[model samples]
Target: MVAGIQLRIGILTQREIPSESEGSEERAKVHVSINPFPSLIPSELSKMSTEKERETHVYLAKLAEQAERYEEMVESMKQVAKLDVELTVEERNLLSVGYKNVIGARRASWRIMSSIEQKEESKGNEHNVKLIKGYRQKVEDELSKICSDILTIIDKHLIPSSGSGEATVFYYKMKGDYFRYLAEFKTDQDRKEAAEQSLKGYEAASATANTELPSTHPIRLGLALNFSVFYYEIMNSPERACHLAKQAFDEAISELDTLSEESYKDSTLIMQLLRDNLTLWTSDLPEDGGEDNPKAEESSKSAEAQEH
Candidate 1:
């Protein structure tokens, strides 16, 4: 319980609050009246006076007199209602820490009271580490096959008149091999070496397209989808990351015609990869990943349920 301490921002007492219905039950008693002076003005004085400026000046003066008292009443109300609050010592110390880590905060969110082993070490021992690696590998294997098929299709369809025909040939084996690597890839060096093999083809295509063509050329579309799949499928989703994969494949199809007719003939692998995981979505986010979906399970967080 707090004693009667007068904080600067403390809540107002009832005595300070005013009731307008009971105060001064009468009209204000002042009014001003005016009349023009008679027979005292020269006719020349009226000819030189600026009419609009004089009216504006007189209007401002009247407004200033009315506004002064209105400003005072507002200031009085602010003074009565404003407060300076006092937080508990714990709260004050926490405020000193400034910001909270917001990315993963939830009821399940917790701080490490003391640490020797990691938070998940008890669960993720050698056995579980191997399991996680296996799961991760399964994702990469599917993605590699998709990457390979796209490159093969690009080679078979080698577009004419775009001057990138040579690039299609050059990148053919490189891209196809990248597709195979999602399974055999072990470390950063292996991935880097494989990517370096394809870099020359990308650079050559960039140089060729820049000469007789503008940036909006259809070649960019093929490249963009290729990279999009690489970034999202290989990197983010893996085997389970095939969301919208077919749509991306289809959207990049017209550009495929710009390559050669044979470019897409052997593209069955790409089609197969795209169709692999069309059934899942964010609607299937894992329920047992240390949290419950409030929408999916409204009764999960009840205190009574936990006590049992």
Candidate 2:
């Protein structure tokens, strides 16, 4: 199972962003009467006014996202971004959805290749080991480029234009997420720098979310969810992770009545995720010491629930 969950951000009534294909009807419903893609005369897009062109690109981007054609989505959103106007929440989500899918595949491949390389080295297969390492490096380079590109957009465009609100919190959360991806494979000083930057981004997001957004707001809960995850996975601080998760879960529970119908589903889903992690982490915590040893209680628990 995937160890941690990612935030599913979208406009009201939008379902969680699907990993595979989402219906084009749902996307088209979001924006009607827009021109479709190349099959329907691509030249007409250029002939449209700049405003119309931007609208077309945004529509295309959303459609590409639903189709999981992320490269096409990125191309279309890049055109939208070039207009240099403040991106609406849906546009920001579309941009992130595109880049994340593109980069996520590379990150997954790099991890698998790294594991294979280690096994090849153990088997004294130098040729296979070298090839795996080389491929992993290439994947890492691509990941770095993708992460850098998005981070630049967040700092240069998104952050400046987003004053103080959920948008600002959302941008900072994205900044942290990309930095965490960078820290996953980087080494030495580079890894340290990436980790520090990731921490800064998450911390800024937490501060802003706490002040500006309600406890039951999907963006705020999502920030807490990811920030606690950073503590556990990146910082190796299960104690801090549990504390943060518990705090957020508790606070959100207190405000459960305040959750609007539009956000109720996303908010509750994230809250459930936070609760699940808390259960996992708390059970794994060391019994006799302050130090967190997540594996300490695993064997006993496994023995109790053994199935063979």
Candidate 3:
């Protein structure tokens, strides 16, 4: 999601940001000319005092988003989050964007390595299997750290400081998303723990959405989108996934007229996503069985074993 801000002029500044990897001295110069939002002028940022550090970090985070320097963006947002103040919707979006991009690549890599490792093991290629396992473990470790750190921010700072239900729902949804990320690669006890935490987080968000948000709200719709995904992907419950997605989509469709112009695009976009997932999953559903279906059970068991 882009930080929705408008600006008229560019600010030229040099920043020394650390590399994504630990112990790296790499830095990049941020050309504010590329900033999507020019509403905040350079002079204003320059004249801000120490008390305005939050704004400065927020501005830098936006710049990093424009630069595709997600690590810096994540770092800057972490500082903003640590401030223990309620986050604006724009700031929350930037925070999610930063961590999502930073962790997304690693998740993709881990999945690829998992696939390759299975092939190597099946062929009895011990050497290649060992190497793939090692690299995959490193990726898993990084994913674990990222998820844990973000969860800490959500549980300790964001949730408590959230003065509005909108903010509460957003924070809980984010918590669920990161925990589901952990369940993607974690195994055994770790997988079980992540899955349970994910469910609790999504459940909390859903409960809040039921009373605190309108059906057509983007945050509510987004929560439905991801919560259904958790059921389908992590829990191996296509039926539940489809049910959740369809219910959310239908409810939102019924309330389409209530959607605000500001969130019309976002809410509609998520509704489309929900409908798409429902279509795909419903087509794959079993004819006359529930979670106890033998095929579903076998598939879930096989996937569980693969994580080990």
- Top-lDDT candidate index: 3
Q: Per-residue CA lDDT of candidate 1, range 1-308, in tens?
A: 32233223222322122234546333333233222333435454353243334334334433533564323332222221121122222222121111111111211221121121233456557665565555555544544544444344344432221134433332332342343233224358766555554544444543553453332233333332343334232343322223344454464454554554443433433443334333322343344553322233222121100000
- Tens-place lDDT per residue, model 2, 144-172, is 99999889888877788786588888889
Against the hidden reference, what TM-scores do the models get? 0.27, 0.77, 0.79
Residue 36 accuracy (lDDT) in model 2:
40
Q: Candidate 1, which segments miss by more than 4 Å at Cα?
A: 1-124, 159-189, 216-308
Q: Write candidate 3's Cα lDDT for 6-96 as tens digits.
A: 3345344444455445455444534444543457666665545433988999999999999999999999999989887888878888998
Error of model 1, residue 32, in angstroms: 99
State in Å the error of residue 61, model 3. Answer: 0.5
Ranking by lDDT: 3, 2, 1
Candidate of highest TM-score: 3
Error of 2 at 31 (Å): 40
Residue 7, candidate 3: alpha-carbon lDDT: 37
Sorted by TM-score, highest first, which candidate order results?
3, 2, 1
| Model 3, runs deviating above 4 Å | 1-51, 292-308
lDDT of 2 at 78: 77
Report lDDT (Cα) of residue 34, candidate 2.
34
